[model samples]
Target: MDSNAMATDSTSGPTANETEQDGRVDEHNGPGKVVYEYEDPAYRVFVDTLNYLEPEEIEQVLAAYRFGEKAHQGQTRLSGEPYITHPLAVAGALAEWRMDAPAIIAALLHDVMEDTSVSKAEIAERFGKQVADLVDGLSKLDRIEFQSYQDAQAENFRKMLMAMATDLRIVLIKLADRRHNLQTMAPVRPDKRRRIAHETLEIYAPIATRLGLNNISRQLQDLSFKHIYPMRFRVLTRAVKAVRGNRRELLSKILDGIRSKLQESNIEAGVFGREKSLYSIYHKMVDKHLSFSQVLDIYGFRVIVRDVPTCYLALGALHSRYKPVPGKFKDYIAIPKANGYQSLHTTLIGPYGTPIEIQIRTQSMHHLAEEGIASHWLYKDSEESGADLQVKTHKWLQSLLELQGASGDSSEFLEHVKVDLFPDEVYVFTPKGKILALPRGATVIDFAYAVHTDIGHRCVAARIDHELIPLSAELNNGNQVEIITAPHANPNPAWLNYVKTSRARSKIRQFLKAIQQDSSSALGENMLNQELQALGVVPSEIPAAVWERVIRDSGKKSRREILTDIGLGRSLAAVFARRLVANDEVPQNEVSESKPLVIRGTEGMAVQLAPCCQPIPGDPIVGLLRNGQGLRIHTHACQATRKSRTTEPQNWINVEWEPDPDQCFDVRIRVTAKKVRGLLGRVATGISQAGANIEHVNMDGKKPGLFIDLHFLVQVSGRPHLAALMRSLRRIPDVVRIVREQE
Candidate 1:
């Protein structure tokens, strides 16, 4: 007999009104209405679940239950029932799914630490450290204040996931807890109900699906849909009922035909019709833009046999009897899904051209499809299969750890996890014939990371089916991919635009951050050295003690960090140099004079020449020290600079052009020419002869046989080159006028 059936509550210690007999609890007639009587049904369900556990394990579960019952003795749920009933319901669900004894105990005590005064240490002392730790992982940090409700929720979720990474049981218990909560949310306020339901749909449902718990995922989705859109749920529910009535005869005929054919082939199988979940039908309607009648697969069938070989045989038998739909067959048993889902799915053309979807699987596979990772505990004696499942689950959780390390914050980590949750996978192969499954839109970079982190970091090119392709190429199913890596190659920021997987995005972001830090440090050092030279002090000659003092004063770690800040425009080098040299000790002549700002087109990212006026060599340019942005050179005639001159005069600095500019710049020009066949040709020829390349051209083609306004974006060395080009264009026969365009 299970000890849970005999255990008494520790606090109340078996009240006189309560009686325990024959492994059952009964309440006698009393002055007050008995809450225990109301809870007897749930207690019986819990007692029935103990048959799956060993005699020794049953004692441990009873201890946990007694402790939880005492901890939550006076507490009541939102439904005005004893709080013990909630935990009991969650434990019952886990038991029905055949979860391990430890998991069941953890589910019973999941809320103890958060709601009661009980400590993890006490639970650890009473029930072992494993149960205590699981309860701790499920408990949220409710007392801490957060910036917002969303922030608190995100942090709580992050903590839960981190704990889940350590032990997969934490998440399983959490799913059970959430399932029970979602099932009993009718008494909640409307706004709160919608919030909780939406979160379940978005976060928990996807997690359940990813963990291969399809039954729980589907139930969560349907429950959440009912709360989120009650009207749509009702309308769809009625419509499905109507459809079921209309299709009863057709579904019965299909089932009978499949059963008769299998029997004739001496195959014993169970054939049954499966209706699509309401949430699934609603999702299909919204995503595929289909009406209620357009969904043909609403009524499908599942065929379960004894073993894997029989599963294939059933598929063959079904295909022979009915015409199979082309390109609608998938053999998941040969290659199980990432979530360990295996089945043979095929669609057939039924009578009157109706499409009937069918799923064939073995008995064990069917169990796994419903319970997912939890199915391992159903047969606890089979340790080998349990270990195999653990290995696969560990690999997926390890990837989550990688994502967390690469992500910037908790919110970003959550977003990346969301991206990985719903996987419409496309399987591809490597050069060695090893297969990898990725999301449908996954690219070559995603494949490289799926192979290894080093390969992803150094991925420079790829070969799809032995043909060279760009990195942004989307991978197709069954394609052979070969990634080409170079030692010096690095991730490009542009790759983030197309890379689909969270792993690739996270890794690329990490690489970009490291590169930016290195570049900023180098630039900051250069700026500080230049400033020190102006102060008559060599940077290398500075004493270590003085440098340490400066670092301490600036609240920075080292000279490199300070310099990096300077280079990144986060700090001013001149201000720091003045402090380092002591303003009074510096020469007055050097302190009073301003340094001349130099402009070269090759300064790269540190100096940007504004595109508004397109400042180039020989143009009057002014440098503006925009906050956190190193020198921005703008033309004198530019309206943006003119506006800034009034609002922020101190930010403006004088800048001059280099003597011999090597880089070309774009300048726009307008040419008013007569409408003629050869006019455009002559203008283009003149500009070409002047050694200016036309980057782009726009003509006023709205009116015919009139003066045409031709705008050309031409490449030139400086203002002199542009002037010469304009002069040359004016010399054309049909050219009436020509001038440089400015903004």
Candidate 2:
């Protein structure tokens, strides 16, 4: 039997209406009532914590305990104890937080459906649908087939998150279940222990912290650290023990000094000392690359006050007594964290010049800080605080729903959720004075997405603090951002390189995928028509039956599908044309060829210029049908295409640029100039004056002389425009030679 629920050996007298059987109390039943006198000590402990609930609710909880106790009768844990102890302990942990009846009931029966003959329908029939739903959500989906362990985990997490979107309490129960399992994992094998510990550290601990359950989060972290790094944990434990003994006197002196200062200021507060958790210390050491001995500020003090205003007074009193470390003070009370955490944090030089961290907050704030969402029932005064945290959590969960809607698969959803788990945040503002909190290193595009999805999709540029900035600019703590949007603007593929938030990335990808499909369909139609025209055939002239036959023969659903395949180079346009025209009796080569396909500069992603050769509009170009990459245009003289042209002649298509393309194309040029102070400035000015824009510039200093080669990637309208810019640059005094680079 588990130690928590072992048979009692006490020598106390029995009470009335209670009888002991095999050192356990017999079940007592009455009219519309359920009771037990001296059941398993663990169940007694769990029941004692439920005094805060109504009498009827408490009876319902006891009924659940009875049901679970019977359901897990034959099951045994790795320790050879009855499995009921595990659920009992999990429920007891939640009861300590004063969770409501349904939560407690769900915690007791969370694993029954997964491990026993119990079903969700039975649970619902016994309890209410709400309780059954909570239990079902807590159960893992391992029974369903998956390709791999990772896929199963991701799908399970995705299912839980969807459940959490409906009710936040599901995760709470699940976290508690995980907590007890980790506590009793000693009997498990070493590899399994490490795997469970790693998952807890990576996913559960961060989640607990994100939900503002600081106390539970710390315990989970420490437990996971102890399992994952046993040797390191022992070393750190010994080190902390030694340090604690040595710092005893210093800690007392600091506490006395803070108490005296607060007393002198007439600030009524409770000041207490706190030690950093082992996991926190270990992470700090690893993150800052600091030795264990060099890690100071390991001990801290917290001042709990009556209200928010008194928190500031307590902070002032402490600062007046000790010199505060510069740039180490943060006032989260004014602007709470995204998790609804609020406290005044400061680091002060202690009696012996050792830094000591301090946090000052109201009593309610302290309660919410430790209990987080559980504070909704843990304390009566924390209702408002719990509601605030709930709002933030609800918003986060809603974003998960949006991510699920936009994500392609479970693994991708998991990737996006992991990206969002970090709590480090930067608070930025909009032009209208509304505040938005985003993850640290978030860019302007993330801010726009946080504002609204439509704004993000249409945003072209942004002005940070009244200065025009690119969409990729990293936002700071108090940046005032004003997004510039245009109706014609759309998300660029390059934005994916710098977008920090998953929402922005997902939205951009979704929009790009849609537009890419449309562009591909149009391009495919054009290519197919061009091929058909060469056979003296028009697509519109084809009968409905013929079109259906072609689509079905190509194993496509519709005409658009076939066209898109052709446009994406997945199917050769010539093959599709030949198939479409197979029924016709036209002789090959009997009809004169039609005009070559025209290349429009506004084809979006359907037409891509070959970057190796940098072919401009005026250059003679041919289309290379790259598999899954649409048309790749290259100059006929390009060296990269020479081998492909000979080996893969069927993939090549004749294409010509429009007479007057509206967009400029990028081309590379080399400028050999005598090294001088003003050489670059003069060349840049000449290029700008000649109506060309330099997109990139590089200098080669390999030559051991006063001359250097400057490589410029400039955008121009055509060959004539590039020549004009070259002539202008040639007039510079330090310019020795200029030649366009083509390869």
Candidate 3:
């Protein structure tokens, strides 16, 4: 802590109203001097911290101090102090949290590697791997370039998450670093301060809360609020101050009464008052649309005890002393927060009808609350039970690793990280009592997905505590969710709309894309086979291996790939299919004129159907296999098919869907719809009248409140002719833009 941080405020110190001007002299050219100074006298409190650490630790500390001082020798901070002061302040904050020797040492040297010629290996050798690793894990994301502030902000947030997942302490140091920076943010440019403070409020504070660093979280939230929304923060701050003034005497009486009651009960506890951060109060006002005074429980107290049992005793005593706010009590000791914080919380009407919140925890838990995971290292000796949360916390870290496998691309990996790294969680339970923590707003499907990939793939239904709930039902704290799965079940695309967990969302998307690819590939292969038959090329002659090689050379893999290509019109399936089959003695005959055919088949075959020609069951159909897509079935009379026969005739195929298609195929329909009320309903009614199902409907906005162009992707059996369907659609009143799917 530099043994000088805990300085007291003095009249000799620069007043808050005074400003420090920038000193940009060429200090590096000569002996660099302390470019600026600080007035945060609170740092002086850490002189005692030096007592517990050994002399070797002191060496590391001094080395970092000197190294950072020289590296930033010419640098003046936003507050116009020597840049070393910031690092000193950050180190002091970490010391106050009672972090161990290495963490404190790391804090001292945190920015040295980022801003100076000092090498990472140098820090590693001087300070040990632990401290160096922590420093290395800390981000230099700020020093990178981005297209826009938003882009930079997003990337930085992601980098921060990755860094934290790698080592939780980096973020701890970062929070400390951020707190000190924010404390002196006033000297930063107005815009820069706003951005920094807004980010701190939105993300860092929330992270601290999750970690149970209550004091630090409160300070961060308050500071960020002041900068992000000055008016609101000021208004709430003043209002809270007024309320505190009015309740001071009452709260005093209440605390005394409670203390006396506890003493009478022979229970000794440390009780401290807590005031809600201005940002929290303001957020409640804005989010719930409540007036400033409506935010109750803004004033609270914490009761720290010596043992777990004592915490409960304190809670009972608190309840006995005050009328506890109904439904406001929570026993986190049984169901700890995702970040491993455990406590007993109760809101009560304290003396004089003032609503107050009281939190009760053991001394160990209190340390955890104030110091977070870092306390694991700081006071681990005091917690003799072993690190209970190490495995669970590591599991959380492992799940974050699952995000690392989400995509190979850096940007995409970063995107998925954002989704998986949300610090806030809604802890729920499995039917058999296993706890699962998911992000807030996660649904039953997400819960199902979280249980297992197979469960997600086969999820058919869900029951919350033996009662059926919508798959989209949002699970709450402590919900017991049991997923129901069946072999044939698959995730519906609709799940995408409600799934909150990134894992679930990503899996669903991956599965759907795979399905689309397979379907398109199937259509492509079918067309290719038909084209091969037309060319008198036998499928039996060409070995699948040879065909694989040819397709691979073409940069397409698998029969599915070839089919998908044909369907998409990127490549003719007939050309490739015939080229493969004709590898033997088989010879292709000249092309024969034929109309397109629309065929119903029990098999998956669709006689080289061209979506452009929309060959009907009765039409003379010819197939064109796209590059590696679906087989495009085209009518004999189709202009595109005829053009292919001359320009790319190998695409022509003699093919057919089986005698009866078990399912309807997708067909495009464009309808000019009236803008009047119920017009869309009428259109839907018409499609039903023709015994067709509208699989997809997209409607454009109306221009003059009179009409709209509606595109419907319909599924229909071979029972309807294309010409007849078009005629029926055209006959409908108010139908002007009706067209078959076309170029």
- TM-score, one value per model: 0.83, 0.86, 0.71
The lDDT of each candidate is 0.80, 0.85, 0.69
| Better lDDT candidate (1, 2) | 2
Expressed as tens digits, the lDDT of each residue in 1-743 for candidate 3 is 11112222211212223233322112454332223232345333443355455544544454555555555666666445666787877888777666777788778777766666566777776667888888777646656788876776666666666767777777788889888877877766678778788777667777777665667888998888788778877777678889999878877887788788889889988778888777777777788998876787777888888888888888888788889889888888888877678899888887667787888988888777776666666686436422655555566666656665654444555555456546367888887889887888899988988899889989888888789887889988878899888998877889988988778877887776666666555555555555665565545655767777777778865666666666556776556865575454444456544323333532233223456755545555666644534355666677755556888765454665556556666678788867777778777877877777788898887456777988888777653554556666766787776776654
**In model 3, where do residues sit more than 4 Å from their true spots?**
1-48, 98-102, 117-132, 141-147, 381-386, 407-427, 476-479, 513-659, 665-716, 720-743
Most accurate candidate by TM-score? 2
Query: Mind sharing the TM-score for model 1?
Result: 0.83
Superior candidate under lDDT, 1 versus 3: 1
Please report how far candidate 3 places residue 213 from its true position, in Å: 2.5
Give per-residue CA lDDT, model 1, range 393-507, as digits (tens). Answer: 7888888898888887888888888888877999999999998999999999999988988999999999999999999999998999999999988888799999888888898
Write the candidate numbers in order of decreasing TM-score.
2, 1, 3
Best by lDDT: 2
Please list the residue runs of candidate 2 whose C-alpha ends up more than 4 Å from where it truly belongs after superposition: 1-34, 37-39, 66-74, 116-118, 468-470, 531-537, 541-566, 570-596, 642-654, 672-691, 705-708, 720-738
Lowest summed lDDT across 10 adjacent residues in model 1 is found at 1-10
